[model samples]
Target: MNMMVPPPSHSSLYYCFQILLALVLFSLQMLTHQLEASSSKVEVLPGFEGPLPFQLETGYVGLGETDDDMQVFYYFIKSENDPKKDPLMLWLTGGPGCSSFSGLVFQIGPVEFEIKEYNGSVPSLVLRPQSWTKLCSIIFVDLPLGTGFSYAKNLTAHRSDWKLVHHTHQFLRKWLIDHPEFLSNEFYFGADSYSGIPVPAIVQEISNGNEEGLQPSINLQGYLLGNPITTRREKNDQIPYAHGMGLISDELYKSLQKNCKEEYIDVDSRNELCLRDLEYFDECLSGINHFYILDSYCESDSPLWRRSLTHELKKSSSSHLTDTVPELSCRIYSSYLGRKWINNERVRKALHIREGTIGKWVRCYKTDFEYEISDSVEFHANLSKKGYRSLIYSGDHDILVPFMSTQAWIRALNYSIVDDWRLWFANGQVGGYTRTYSNRMTFATVKGSGHMAPEYTPEQCFSMFTKWISNLPL
Candidate 1:
């Protein structure tokens, strides 16, 4: 692993980024007063990585402070052919502590897991081809430090939402400057889960920059989200919809009713029955050990567990791994073990889980949930006002940040339509579909999928993105 260290804390990337955001926020204030500034996207030379023939570069981006020299890891991947033919896609993984690089290893990249060995020992997911890399050159990053190979000096230095957005801006800005040839390429912001929150923030911040005529303008094409946690206020709000929509079974409904009045739900809301069911679902997933309960149907043995995701995972028995292992299962199970599981030579030598993983993961979740509900609203509205593409997608079976939560959040956006909303097949499958509202916002769903939409249904996930960016029907 390449280690990039910053100087002792006199002047740091973190401080500089904050200064930049303060300046941008102040500029927005002036824009409210009708003040004018100049904005344009930067141009950069296309990157290349020799023998492979595609433009690719792996390096550290300077951030935080000039004197202290804080930095983040990012890989720029692009097509070798005409830049205009493919759009620039930024991919981020959740865990706020997790590295964008992990996405490269697990999902949308040239490599994917082959799963050569699967004994009782935890299966080490390996490298295989991700269908998305075939459509677009994807960039993966490690933000807020301690994720994958990303390094940070201390815990306190890595936990701020404001800091995350600031560093992200500088990271992209530097990327554009370093590779000026792809100036005309369209840029799309995207991520999954907790990142669902940060993606909007970064996109909105960029759009805000455009409105104020400050900084360079990015094409800011649109956004692509997979089973994202888009709304906090709507957290428990989706239960009724979940029940009414038949997402949960009648048996599960009764279980919820009996338990909530006695064991789980708060029941103060309007949809008491629905909320009860949703609370049962939440209680069913409160701990990592109970994770298998969420998708027990993926296996081929446990009858009760097998019934949970019956509609989603079509296996008749339990004990069999789901068609595709969930990234959530992989993460939570690993996180539960902490450094104890990292002692293996392959793991220790391959990545730095023992050193920075814990801090990054812990801080990532802390900052995301620590804010007021209104903060999310401001972030979403600001994103739409700036012409940035904002997307909230859900997997029907994803209990973590369920589709119900996303639906409520979309209703909250209320972005005025530039074009009438359109609905159509997303992957040519009856179960998958897309709906575009106001020409700038999109809400879509992947059928029979859980938290990691792409892992469960790569073809559908790829189809959704290709159509979204190219403005074509699947």
Candidate 2:
């Protein structure tokens, strides 16, 4: 059958032009950068007292032919149990812009900021008893440029979700090329939150590279996502989540469902009923903390804080540092302290952070980021069909990425249940629930935890990771 094709509209032509230009610019960036994969061993940091017990290395993997073109910074922590045999993970922190430092110091990392009153000095560091470093060597990266210690000579290079995955995959190859000693170790790609969009895609990139006979073949075993953003529909799932959690009344919930059709994120301006119902929904959720329901919502955790807080505001938040976390979510306070600690000149020098690289490091920044991928279910399906082991978990208390949504996507995979849903334990108590699927994928929930499960329920998350990584049924 022959069909007449419509001429490309002006908007479509412009979009195509934009994509072509981006490709040219990106190729130029590749040629211009002076790629250097450098590493430095650190014995001590400013906050932590005395010599560090675990081995920590900080380095930069250049992404271009010239300096400042793009330098991706990273912190490598060798496995405490057995670096030689333990799984090696290239962990990306979510935010699409958040530093992997969150994964290191806040979530699964060895040392955490001692959450207490900040005496205006460098915040103290305390060792986490359930650090994931015990089971695996982790590479915590400042990915996608302009994130943490990473920087780009041109800010334009810092745009796009596609670019983020591309650069990260490149960084991994360069890193493994430099550290070939760990190439034979079981490798995993892990991340949380917004990384759901990129981590799976990164896995696909790796698989493609390996198939193409790339050097230093990564012993790719599997991957993990903690409270991941699997699909955009999850945001829409929040309305049902709210209603079920008793945040909204049945009458209002019914009204929303009837009028808005559960499309809350983008209600039509012309649809008066839908708009009114959405406003009611907003009113119900206005003061509530979306990250974790249990956490007390503070001024810093407010929407205004997200919109207005600049570099200075982020670096100097001592008001919340008074009297053992009064008026502050412990998570936000710890994050504030982390910002303070990392910005310290001495701390940067100790970690061997490149001078003149970053001006201020925000814990999470989405302003410069460009979102292209709306759903990662395709990547998940593709990876699962290849028999890649996966651990997809959610924090039960997190409304940001609810457990229901995680389960929804997992169910969409159409993999048969290998292990029916059951409780997983830690410390002789229920930690979370778990279920295994036909494709070697396991899904679990961290009870009473938030968006970043490990940040709140470290012990349970650790237990989950240890068991799953060791091939034990959890």
Candidate 3:
């Protein structure tokens, strides 16, 4: 996401974003803010072919306060464009526990894990040309602890969406204090997927602190989100999204719309028509990937037995390699490469991950975090009134948090349409459709993309991002 001082009342879905919840616990005085963060300059990575062309720093920032024993890890990449002038971004990945490293490599970072079958060595890396770092400095973070190399004294105790926002705000302020050189830079809060649950809340916290005249104030321009989950409507919109995409029949859709009132999830037990239609809907999407409907359904598991099967096949090195790993063609297999890479001791040492702090590093920590805030639309509504710019984009193919849900929330704000729905282009072809609102909020779609649209359509997203952030027409 970029911030190029967008035209007044125009927020084309390329510039910036944010999300939100309720409680604001910004007691800066209670926070024992420290300037000394344990960070390392990483010029070389184990799997990369040579020295990194861009600057990379890995470090730990105290979340709530110093001595809190909950360290949040972050990967800071200075903008390849111009750190002195480019906007700075605080990126949060979804899954609630998915490491922001996934955002760094799999989504918008300069480097990505080279996908290949395991040979017991380091998974190689390659550069991504469409990295968002090309536009601005990005701090990809592992929030709420227990993710990536971050550790917490009591992970079980910290299980709320509000806590993530609380700590994330602290993290941003503390990180800025440590690197005061970028204090004047335009800052944005950006995230995707489930993070849409907390990002707006964090943005609110920051806004609250800034208005209270907190020290080292953030220039806080705007925020951006991709395929964001704004409210519980995400569950209610899937059936319609499926129907619109031809994944379900018209008859089934009519039955659902009439009997369920378009609410497939949480249906009344006595509603037999709704129940019957839902079963058919489920059957229709049986093998479809909820994250991306077009892709073959693949379990995102790289279990020990699967690896053992790979090793057993290594005995011949020419066992056709077919069916050995059903996930080979799946995009998640690249995540498997990342899991192995981050867990390697040498890679850990190189990245300066504190030893003994965490167990095997996971791409996403599937924690049953307490869902304290079910609806964050209020946060967006609140931010919209504050006149902070925001860009909300969705991958048209994502059923998990359908674009329809995003549109519903945006409409809920009741802002006048400044720019009507129209297709935005990239490379002279349709990139996606966009609409701007009177509240400085813009919405857009990434054609044929799934969740985390940037991961699947980097160039188009970058094109969309650069244009909106630069205040250029999209």
Candidate 4:
């Protein structure tokens, strides 16, 4: 038997090499076909600012169902001031249904439009230049099969989380496949609420490369979560923490604090006072609206048009007709049209939420949303482990997905710190605080803002992104 084994060595090696070559050739054939179907051109233009040149172009992906493949409408805006100097940002909006284009126009786009007073109707809102687009090329994406102008070929394949992830994966994969050029750009993915899942999941998927040993790949630089809700278990545990932090109300806070203390049978921990203060702060948040947390609009002699239009902006009696939620208000004012301007059908179909339901309606067409807070925490952990950059910025007054939730999430990371945490002060206001964990995950808060932090404080958001893109070490 020993003599036989020695005799087979050279022949076995040659046979193995033949098999490997065949597998490699097969993979190359498959990838070449996929690449051929996906290739497209991206348009680049000189940026108004002297930054890198700017590029904007749209791309679509076919979901592959005989009946209906998902279609993604996406645009990549990149800065080209210096070929070696610009970064790429991928921006998605929450609602699992909201349009990223809406965010671009109303919140962080290159323009802002103000609603006119006196129901003037014609040219109701005037356009104002925004400051964020000056720094980075923003890629606005409409996803999940049914969001905005993006659509699926049929109804049967719609509204699945697995599909959501898969379709997005296919779309983005093809996008890069088409461009192939921007794959090396420093890229970050960010969105609010449910996008918390897709954004991180996609990143992890790309990193896995392929369990099937496929060759198509994505190179992601880092991740940024604006208001991510990843785990239900951790979310429930943190509810009290969220309440303690002023994201909810005192009554809700008191109930949870008492319940947790008794149930856990220990209240003397060093975190007790911090928990108590957090509870107290959160109690006040319940009263805050889903929109318009800014008190400036209510102050008399306020420079905002809302004040000028109201007989008593201070009197909570703002007109219901003209004063719908700020999001809708922006739409009406900008389009110079009535409810007709709102994308009602798309919103209803995409989010799985019925038309015209008030309150924070971010229902995903995926899972029942048992809480993926753990996944979010895990995402931050992995980023820190790989020595990559990440930023978690929250709106101080967002009644929906309160800033308190974000604070609790970070505290739970238990990361070791290089720099003792300190509040980041700006213009006499605590813009936010910076904490460097031994691993490099930095968490910050946007002072005096709501869920739409960038929309409210574009300059600060831009500054944060700019600094992050520089890849500066903590």
TM-score of each: 0.65, 0.87, 0.86, 0.64
Clashes of 1: 33
Q: Which candidate is the best by lDDT?
A: 2
- CA lDDT, every model vs. true structure: 0.54, 0.82, 0.80, 0.52
Q: How many Å off is the CA of 127 in candidate 3?
A: 0.3
Which parts of model 2 are misplaced by more than 4 Å? Answer: 1-35, 303-330
Scored by TM-score, the top model is 2
lDDT of 1 at 105: 45
Where does model 1 exceed 4 Å of error?
A: 1-55, 118-130, 213-216, 237-294, 297-375, 415-428
**Candidate 4 lDDT tens digits, 1-474:** 456445667889999999999999999877545422332333321112232233445544555643124556665555535433456567877655555765665566653444544243222223334434555556677766556546555534565444555566666666666656666666566676556656667666655554444445555677787755554232333445445555567665666556454232233457565456444544454344443355333222122211111112112222222434344333223432322223334423322322332232221222221222235567666666666667777766654455665667677878777767677754456666666666666777777766667777765666665666676532
lDDT of candidate 2 over 40-111, digit per residue (tens): 899999988899999999988988767557888999999999999999999998776778988898899999
- The residue-by-residue lDDT of candidate 3 on 1-474, one tens digit each, is 987985655353333332111112333433434323678899999999889999999988876444547888899999998999999999998876778998999999999988888778999999999998998899999986777777777887776788888888888898998899999999998898778889999999899999999988999999999988777557677777778888888988898899888665567899988788777776777677766777776653211111221121122112222233545787777766777788889999999887777876766665656677777899998999899999999999987778888999899899999999999998899999999999999999999898889988998999998887776768
Model 4 / residue 324 / CA error / Å = 6.9
Model 2 accuracy (lDDT, Cα): 0.82
Q: What is the C-alpha RMSD of each candidate to the true structure, in Å?
A: 13.1, 14.2, 16.0, 14.4
Which model is ahead, 3 or 4, in terms of TM-score? 3
Higher-scoring candidate on TM-score, 1 or 3: 3
lDDT of 1 by residue, 1-474 (tens): 999996758567778888999999998776532211112221221111123434446655555444123556666566434556678877888655565654664456654433333334433433334356666767787776555444555635665666677668767766666566655778888788667767778777776665677555666777777766554433343344445555566788666656454323235467566565655665543342221223543222222221223212223212222233334334333322222223344443233223333332321222232222223556777666655665566776665456766766676777554444344454455545556677377777777766667766666776676666676643
lDDT of 2 at 196: 88
Query: How far out, in Å, is residue 360 in model 4?
Result: 22
Task: Name the runs in model 3 displaced over 4 angstroms.
Answer: 1-36, 64-68, 300-326
